[model samples]
Target: MRMVQKPSSVVLASLKPSTYTNRTPRAGTLPAHRLAGVSKPDAPYSSRRAPRCGLVGRTFSPFTIVLLVILGGVVATAAQEDERATVEPTLARRAATLILARCAVCHTTDLIVQQRLPEDRWTATVEKMVHWGADLTKDEAAVLLQYLTARYHPGAPDHLPSIENELAMTEPLRGQTTATDGPLTGLAARGAGLYAHNCQACHGEGAVGGVGPKLARNTILKNDGVFWETVLHGRGPMPAWGSVLSHQDIADIHAWLATR
Candidate 1:
């Protein structure tokens, strides 16, 4: 084998550290200064720093962090309160509907609205009503009780007028027959259907009395004027039918009741 000759000093001098130091680094390779934990002396200077990410990279004072946490908690609490406010009104409306459908069958709304009682008394009253043929389910009764207690409690405001006060204020109409009154012979058949639809619910089948006074053999039937006044202008829990029924309709109902 022939011996290899050594490189010249000029060639070695030309291949100095400065030549490759300024060159761009290859892909997937670390620069000498970075790998050795050293910085380049002639590198471009910059005031801007590399962007950081995530909570770990962020810096906040203890007070600022606590304030942010408190604000978040407040927002969460307010959202919960708003949800409760919305739900409460929905429940109240449902309960009110139940009361109107079920309770108003026997008694008027004014009778119920005027009373102010405790929860226990309300419970007793509700039980009594259920016993007296109020068609209420267990859940419906419970919901109704909750509504009554909330709205008609002892501490609640007495805004509605008393039924006794209302009755006392109004004078009884005397001899108040309508112009449509006539012979009751031919009209009784038509009046039967009208009475069944309008008056039968409260007055009982054949005017024998249920919630209202028994119309069977009642002296008021003989007097056409008093009957007309009572029917047209409401009495106690009875609603005024003047707005609902025509004069002929009232006369027809009267004719049917007279036969009963």
Candidate 2:
């Protein structure tokens, strides 16, 4: 029982290595499972995935780059058109100041914009208005006339007939007393357009007075001289048009008002 039992030589030899090789893994080498293309239990293939293919760290194809360029171009062009569409504040302010001070008293901007008169006509019109009690001084009139002539010259295809020319042409008709007696219907019809342009703002769309007294049933209609005087020289808040309107224009407007 005290004697030690020696292992058999075959058993001892079987336990010993033939070449005594030390197999410590080298640094920067994958684990056995990973080297064999097998996922490790602790670190899975799905969790330690290859770098994903996406916009990040990825090169764009030529077609993709072209699409991006075209989209950018479209955005830039739209931005430029938006800029052009807007009106300049300075220009708008200048026009508004002049128009409101001198022209807006008698009529809306619509009336002024609708007429595309020549330089001479615009000058004459502005001068006439000043004479008839417009608040403008000579310098202001010049500025306003310049603006009007520049923005609304008669060179435009849609420019309206000159007031002077229209009046000069209608003078013969005004002299004919029989023109009024034969049938006021025709005269009233023509006067409708003129009334809408000139008198509608104050006398109203139907001559029922907004800023001015009602003209529909006014007794002043019976007296031609008083009616003409009231219109040409203005009454109270009414602006005078003695220089602006011709006798024929006034007569026609009166005829239209009489109908109303």
Candidate 3:
């Protein structure tokens, strides 16, 4: 029979589960089982190894953590861009409507559409108009300002459906007046342009009438109060211009139409 040596007290003490559980093994030190020349049983998985499926037990390098953060930011920015694209067109349409309904009342659309101004200048212009009696709520003014800056910025293309073309088409008809009539001057001249822009569309060239009733020789022009009331408050099918045209603007238009 082969003789076996008794295990030392130190080796037996180190073999206890409490020894391994209570303290980490020193570097270069072997487990008690390895030192004793006994093989450890194979575990299904090692607790020291990183988990394959989840973030648990994982240790990322500094570079990897930074890269993950960058990716998350990229995703968030892309989502915001998509949302802005969806909302921009609707806001643009609303802005266009406000411009037509409000700005076009006093001056022709061409006056507003022709200029390419920067944001600060546009803001100043809009504010000036408000100060001068434009009827716009704070919200409406803000929306209009945003639209003007975006669509009429210095870098933007010129507005289309050319004002020059419209002017050319109406100029000849506008120039023709009765042999007894004198040349237009002052507020009357200004009103000619306003009438052409605002009234000619429905009232026909020189307010001769088409969709709207004839105003060329309409007796309504004889009474200032009736004319102001009808134009500002609207008639049967006409929309009110009270919120758009200032008193001075309506007066100028009246001065010009009286000639027609």
Leading candidate by lDDT: 1
lDDT of each: 0.57, 0.52, 0.55
Candidate numbers sorted by TM-score from highest down: 1, 2, 3
The order by descending lDDT is 1, 3, 2
* Candidate 3 local lDDT, residue 133: 65
lDDT of 1 by residue, 1-260 (tens): 11122212112222222221122222345444443444345424322322221134568643344444345445433433332232244345445555544676677667788776667788899999999978677777877776565555443343633433333233243434465545444377888987776777788999999888898789998897888788876677776555345677777777878887
Ten residues in a row with the worst lDDT in model 3?
1-10
When 2 and 3 are scored with lDDT, the better candidate is 3
Please give, for residues 122-179, the per-residue lDDT of candidate 3 as tens digits: 9899999989867667777876776565445443333334322432332233322122
Give the TM-score of each candidate: 0.36, 0.34, 0.33
Q: Candidate 2, which segments miss by more than 4 Å at Cα?
A: 1-186
Q: For residues 54-172, could you state the per-residue lDDT of candidate 2 as single tens digits?
A: 23555874334444444544543343333212223233333345564357567645577677565678878888888887766555565566556544543232443333332233333
